[model samples]
Target: MTAELLEFLEELSRALIASGNSVTDTERILWSVAESQGVEVEVSVLPTMIIIKAEGEVSRMGLAAQSPGMMPLHQVTEIYRLTDDVTSRRMEVGEALGELRGI
Candidate 1:
């Protein structure tokens, strides 16, 4: 589950950044989503990469390559929707990953 959570977080951060969200906004969203799952995460979002450190019984760090870019308004909206679903627990990690990838 932790591994899945890390993968989901990385994907979510990348999507947010590519949608033109600022680092602060991305961090807040990640924190919210992690909190919903009762996980503590330290996330760093940059134009070139996203780094996430999850603290728990077994702590781990994951990185996802990111490139600075902007998406269409509709695509950005879809990404936000998926993020809301994850933060609200309306979607599971696997489901959210699929949805994010689809967007």
Candidate 2:
């Protein structure tokens, strides 16, 4: 479960960055999602990369292949909605991942 959550966070971080979120906003979202799930994660994000560390043998560093760019407004809205659902525990990690892929 830790690994799955970590993977989900890494992907979420990438998505947030790629969708033009600032590093600070991205970090806040990551922390909120992790904390809401009752997990402790160390997250660091730059314009080009993100690092996530957690217990239970989960660690990930994700590098962006390109610069951050704007996504469509609807896509950005979906991402925020997803984040909200996760933080509120209305969506499980697995289900969030599936929904994220669709975004």
- How many backbone clashes can be found in candidate 1? 0
Which lDDT tens digits does candidate 2 get at residues 25-47? 99999998999988888999998
Q: Which ten residues in a row have the lowest lDDT in candidate 1?
A: 56-65
State model 1's lDDT. 0.81
Which ranges of candidate 2 are over 4 A from the true structure? 67-69
Give the top-scoring candidate (TM-score): 2
Predicted model with the maximum lDDT:
2
User: RMSD of each candidate?
Assistant: 2.3, 1.6
Compute the lDDT of residue 71 as modeled in candidate 2: 78
lDDT of each: 0.81, 0.86
**Model 2 TM-score relative to the real fold:** 0.91
